[model samples]
Target: MRNAPLGALETAAALRRGEIDVRELAADSLDAARGVGAEVGAFAHVLEELTREQARTAAEGIEDARRGGTLDELGQRSPLWGVPMPIKDLTQVAGQPFEAGSMALRGNIATVTDGVAQRLLDAGTLTVGKTSTPEFGMPCYTEPATGAPARTPWDLRRTAGGSSGGAAAAVASGVVPIAHGSDGGGSVRIPAACCGIVGIKPSRGVVSPGPYSTEGMGLATDGVLSRSVRDAAVGLDLIAGPRDGDFMPRPRPPMSYLDSVGRAPGPLRIGVLLEPLAAKTDVHPAALRGVERAIELLHGLGHVTTPIPAPFTPQEWAAFMPLWSVGAASIPLEAQQEGELLELTRWLREQGQGYSGVDLAQALSGVQAIARRTGEAFSAYDVVLTPTLSGPPAFPGELQLPGGADDFGAQCAFTPWTSSWNMIGNAAMSVPLHREEIDGTELPFGIQLGGTRPGEEALLLALAAQLEELDPWPLVREPSAA
Candidate 1:
């Protein structure tokens, strides 16, 4: 049981039956990770000793709870009890050093634990260790110059999408059922689409980032990437509480996200947008095919579909581009000057350095107005479905910083859809609903589904549950042990 890719629920069940002890599970996971992780490049740091300590403590505490009459027969004290999961290197887990996939931040250890990390601990999930990310989590491909570039389990040559590439790789490789990820732009969904998993970027403030967060940027959100919909739902519940001293709180959902999964999505009037906001970028055949397939699946599930032409123009995209440059530029110069910042970091910082402050303010204000404009478009439908990534998994180093302005220019061209949702601070997800034809080589291609503000759990997961029943990408076989 410990060797299998059991979900949070299944693990709890096995623990109740004594099929495997928490210690045995932790040890097996560590061994399996050591054996298979090298091939997939899923983990940045594997904490064997720390994981064992956590498992040992969890086992003792469960036993104590049994004796204390507080634990159930299933050992299900919480939705996440006894599950093995990985925290993305971007989030600070106390007592652990966070490299964030950059040499610049090497040896940077967290003196304090963050709210999300503490919440996972409180909910009884055993974190194995930190997964990888690109430098400052700045790119959609995880080929950080410093750390190991995380690759997809399906095709080793292809990328596991970044900046949450490490977490996505860990899940795809079956190192864990689910892993923590932060999505500023498409960090969560891009890799999830590339690796064939579920990535949910909840509405801003759905999961708090307090004591260290600035309010209302609409740029970043904390979430998870998981093998199954239920796994993501379970993890969200554990970490969804409001943190101390937060300015904006996610409106409390009336029910748990797990409960939302099995509920039928009913007949949703979905508006399909075939073209991205670009004037002339080629939509990958695989990506278009994926959207077509998802449309069929959703229609079979009884959802009404209407094809809507691209409502926003490239002019609007021009309005949005400066924000990306501004964000890229906002990388602290001190880090670049002092820390061992990667080439991409230094390049982005240099690019950002040229923007005027008024330019940033204008771009930000335009983005907010665009969000409102897009929200009005969404008012016409229950949901909108589109290809998650414009193409299938990019080959390793394909998205590295290109010489001249063309490098950043090309990146913006490739990933046009994901950032728009981030701009609006809506709940968006990439679901592994289809696999594109990549010759004989197989990699997951998925569809991006976006919900209106604060309707993330209802719009995305409910549909995801329906689709999961139609075509499930259950944990695939792990890489053969060497």
Candidate 2:
């Protein structure tokens, strides 16, 4: 009961030692979540009584396991025992209201649980609530018409990059230590960079997105937004693996993700990418400073770093937009709800609807071609490091509507490097390694490190954890202190 907001490992050990009651821990988490959450607009729903009930159930089960002499097995099965985990509104949770940050289906309830979400519960995670996201998760910004915009703790007026914006905001603001996030075209990593947290997008199939989902353009996959690499690894372990009828399935990782963090990745070759595919803007000085520091740190740790060429052509990059747009229109939005969509969503959907089946197929094939090309180049290097975004968090509505033009091309300029990992189905992480004062304000910036292949996920985690140890960022920010 004494630990107010312990880290993932500390929380589990505390729960095992009976030093803290699950209900109290959950209550504390909910209080913090709602307290900072109110101003940040992080949650769409706070499953209050449901969270308490879940904590009570897990607490009783811990005692039951102790009496039955199966405590060690329980520990092995549930390493994050009774810790709080917030569900991103992008995923479905059975019986929970889920509209995905839209007014169209505001009262719709999830009839079946998403596979990634179920695995979290089975691992004894105390589910706290749901984080807000963009409508149908089409945009990288997180201001939804149904609720308030999800804002950065560093500057409330700045954007909390999305579609996992609320998840990043809550985790970054010390509301919860870790929260579920999804990365499709940099949704997870983008927000993390904005808020100064770790966001890892696993290999496409490593985490399932099933049981009623259109997230399978092989783009969006569930992950975690956390303060530390180890916390993200704990989340990956709990959620990784295949479901019974998965869209994209891969073999289990060679080792538990949690175990990989403490193990060193060893010396390796690293590539630095400055110009991202299709991006026209020059790299922001703040962003370059963060990744430059990362390169220096890696050099100090005995790794080689050098410049790398951009892998995709302008034509290949152009095709991805239509392919992703086709996926957006593929979703079965009820005819009645059609009028409720944002102008940007409706316009994108219309563009997708105009494409012939052959056109859509060609677009998907083009995307795959680009992915293959990128993957081949990645094999030569252990890791490719880049700035997670072109710049620090932009002002909240700068790229959003209400007088804003919905030019995705312009938005993509801000986050050109991140989505390519999604296209290639590689594991990537945003490490908060740099902070600097600009225009009389100091904000955090992230450096990205991505794996060449699925098996390289462990190496990526180990490397990120090593960086955190060598030059750690503030784990979390409390709004009260701000």
Candidate 3:
């Protein structure tokens, strides 16, 4: 039997106390990536040689710190030191494959590392490989035509969720304790909920989107997928900061996010909304039950839960679709390369091309209006609660539909509650608080928590940590080779 893996924080602590070395930890992680990760199709690439070299370098650096009597300080500065994690394929790591889950870019390697990837390297994390994402990260599912489908370790037939689906699978299946993920529109949180893990989507501008910030109109930001809230918080601290040319850099937090996890958030007003905001689909009972459980937990913890109207409207969603299509259209591709694009990507691109510049401007203005309305509505509460998805985890290929409205509509229905927070530019997370047996397999269901204000991730983390303490979720699933 394979041994359970230690979480990011636990691994860092062990390295600090000399309980384990970085090389050994990296080896174990690589083993899992090659073994269970392959079985789950969680990794798009595995850099065994690069990982081994990094482990040696990291182990040497730790030894030097120990000899200099600065090991404690090093640990304090880089909380994720010696941790093995995978970066989402959407982010560039120089010399690594930068396919972005598209067959057209299959052999392309990154020439320059993205700002987020550099920050992770500075934190002393060893990158095992790139996790799978959907083509251009336009879809919510991660069944890329370039490689294997990223499946949930909980059930191989089910999707891991995307475009950070592979990252969630790796974390949930013990291939790694935590993995780097990005959230454009529930990409991180959707997969986290599906795989029974924690996903953190920081407020807009909290994490820099440098070197390529204009891609998603600032809707997408890098985040983390991890087993524990504290791990996610530590991850936030590692990568949350302003770059030299950020469009709208957020101010630094008053305290470290890890510190916030321990502080008790006093009783505060939490608004619960069960209605689907953007999609005109009925919320599934399983999804509603997850929110109901979260409400009960909040009540028991001394916080008040009140039902609130959906702050977002269908009209705003109509405006948002054009912007999303425009994002897909913005990708620089050669005319001849268009045929290499996925059906969904091509459809979105075509839709984007059909919109006039006037239409694009109108859409942008509409998005701003939606953001203003959402901010005003959410100001009344400390946090907002909803189901992470409108339904349970989907089976492989279940969400795929014919190109155009059918595909787009199916995506929205599955992830009705997530994109609104992206539009609002506020912090949000998916916390796995409930599970149910489906076809004899226990599948995880998570509730979404949105912070009232931008850069309020600390508040969300505090509540998630409290809930974890009261009724802890499993850290990882049993050893699975699919």
Leading candidate by lDDT: 3
> By the lDDT metric, which is better: model 2 or model 3?
3
Q: Judging by TM-score, tell me the better candidate of 2 and 3.
A: 3
**Residue 119 Cα positional deviation in candidate 2, in Å, after optimal superposition:** 0.7
TM-score of each: 0.93, 0.95, 0.97
- Give the CA lDDT, 0 to 100, for residue 16 in model 1: 55
- Across residues 192-263, which tens digit of lDDT does each residue of candidate 2 receive? 998889999998888867656644578778888888898899888998887668766877778799998999
Clashes of each: 2, 1, 0
Alpha-carbon lDDT of model 1: 0.77
The candidate, 1 or 2, that scores higher on lDDT is 2
Best by TM-score: 3
Whole-model lDDT per candidate: 0.77, 0.83, 0.88
lDDT of 3 by residue, 1-482 (tens): 24567889999989988999789888888988888888778899998887888888888879999999998898898888889988999999988889999988979999999999999987889899899888978888888878998888878888889999989999999888889999988999999999999999999999988865543577888999999999999999988988787778897788999999999996989999888887898777888998888888889999999999987776567778878898889889998889999899999999999999999899989988988888898888999999999888887555888756788888898999899888878999999999988778788899999988888899999999999998888888863333
Candidate 1, RMSD to the unseen true structure: 2.6
